[model samples]
Target: MRAEEQVEAVVVDDIAERLRDGSREALEEAYARWASLVHTLAVRSLGNHHDAEDVTQQVFVSAWNSRHTLRPDKGTVPGWLVGITRHKVADVHAKRARLARDAQAVAENTLPDESAPPPDDLLATRLVLHDELERLGEPRGTIVRMAFLEDRTHDEIAERLAMPLGTVKSHVRRGLLHLRTRLEEVDRDPS
Candidate 1:
């Protein structure tokens, strides 16, 4: 192998060891090296940057928390991380699929109670909007929840999340647009 490959092997070995021991520093190093790959994988699979970012964080946290499960004798750290990433991406996609299914049911106006009570149109609309907001995921989902569900102002959300005002606003705006598109679809086909 080349000298660079040797160096990388040594580094991966070190990370593997640190990870096994639950060292926080090694977690940071691992994130620095592999977060981009994880994030990109999530984004490509899920097509949502917010969801991708959440998945990347989830991958690292779950890996580090369960680092004891990783065995160097079995595989390289990068390969292990890739496996974790795949599972996390799948989880995010699964959640989205569930949300889509729920939203579709709401859109179709199906209910178990035919005479118990009338379908709450506003509640159904909220459910659809909330479903899309969750698809935004993580900070965006939390941000939208605070702003709408909690009646928080944009500045308040930024302050609470320690995010810039512009970023909070952007998330809210984009999230609203996503919800709008979903609502329009439902509006066009309310069965």
Candidate 2:
């Protein structure tokens, strides 16, 4: 074997021996020796250093916690750590996939259908209509808002405003024409 690999194998063998004898320092030495390899594997699989760090921590915690269950006769320390790292990496991938699916579901639920007018266009139209109504002012604006927006009838408007029925009808017709003209002008010259 190469120099570093031979040294690593020796270190792994030593750590395994310490662990089997219930040495308290074995776990720390195990983490020091293998943490980079575990973290590197996690980062490659997860594509993010933050997630890789979390997985690396989880792998060591799981290894330390389950140290008593390990069979040193059946496996080396590095082999056991590699298994733990695999499981941690899988868990991270599952979490990332779940988060991605949840975000997609939320977007689908909140967004309008593709066929509908875009939100910005709808908002701009409402604002422009409101501005034009304000510019109309006085009886025409008030009458139009009541008749269309409030769903009021001509008789209701005339009696509410204390005016002649013919005057309310005239205002409704002229206001509609004026709004149509204003809207058409805006549509033609959007700038």
Candidate 3:
């Protein structure tokens, strides 16, 4: 294996040994060393720092809670931690996406009328959409809003954002792909 993988293997071995020996300090150290890495991976995949941190904490807490079932010979502890982090990240992403879709549906059903104030549900959905857009970050969120939310053409978004047409198109495509993946995740969940 590569040097980094070798180091990871060593760390996993040490952590497994500590757990087997019932050393609390070693378990804490293992969590400390891997938490940042796990969080970073989660944030990259989920596009939300809060969700990433949650997944990271869940991974470590579960590892500790299930320590009795761990078998080092089957796999490295770090590998197992990564697997848990991935599942937890997916779960959180699915939940957030479902909330977003539900909010969107409620928003669509309660349009504002000139004679009356906007419905509370519509206002809530707008807030959730705004928060989700902000969480998406950068040109991707802006591009998605302009192209999809605002009904602007890709060329229009390019002109508005002061970017090349191809760049705007790329951002729209990527943003849509990400959104689709999140939606599919929500659909797949039994909960």
Candidate 4:
């Protein structure tokens, strides 16, 4: 190998060794080197910055907590971190799916028996739309839910959420537009 490349490899190996030996400075160095890689992978997998950031933090914390299990003989530190990131991403997916299912169950139970239930396709569509709404995250998600689902006035949502009227309106408008695009995609794919 080239001398420069060999030097880089040795440096990395030294950092990994220090990290596995329970050195906090090594952990910080590792984060500085690889946090962006982890964060980017998370953003690509999760499709949102908030969850991406959460997953990034979880990955480092997990790596530090489980450092004793890290075996350089098995793989490099980056490879180990990638494996942890994949697991964390899967966890987020499972959590999102579970939340969607719980929301669906609540909606189903609240229906009056005397009323004719919606068709299966309609119910499925509602579930997908609801899931997208949740993916919006934060003030946008809550604002859209309050404004559209609950049929609350903009002023009322503003008062209740303690957000400015303009901000509430903006969120609702943008959130609806995003949902509309998602609905269009669903219509095209129907999967």
Pairs in clash, predicted candidate 1: none
Residue-level lDDT of model 1, residues 121-164, one tens digit each, is 76576666656766877667666666776678999878766579
lDDT of each: 0.80, 0.77, 0.73, 0.84
Instruction: Provide the lowest-lDDT 10-residue window in model 3.
Output: 105-114
Residue 127, model 4: Cα distance from true site in angstroms: 17
Task: Judging by lDDT against the true structure, name the best candidate.
Answer: 4
- Model 3 agreement with the true structure over 40-123: per-residue lDDT tens digits: 889999888877877888888887887876778898776777888888887776656654664465335434454766686565
Q: Estimated TM-score per prediction?
A: 0.59, 0.54, 0.52, 0.60
lDDT of 2 by residue, 1-191 (tens): 99999997777778887876777699889888789989999899889998899889998888877877677678888788889999988876765565455435533543445687667766566666677766766567677777776678999988866669999999899888988998888778767
Report the Cα lDDT for candidate 2. Answer: 0.77
- lDDT at position 95, candidate 3: 59
Screening candidate 3 with a backbone cut-off below 3 angstroms (N, C-alpha, C), the clashing residue pairs are none
Which has the higher lDDT value, candidate number 1 or candidate number 4? Answer: 4
Q: Which candidate number has the best TM-score?
A: 4
Give a tens-digit lDDT track for model 4, residues 43-134.
99999999999999999999999999888777888889999999999988876775465446544543434467678777667777778877
Candidate 3: global Cα-lDDT?
0.73
Candidate 3 stretches with Cα past 4 Å from truth are: 1-11, 20-22, 113-191
Better of 3 and 4 by lDDT: 4
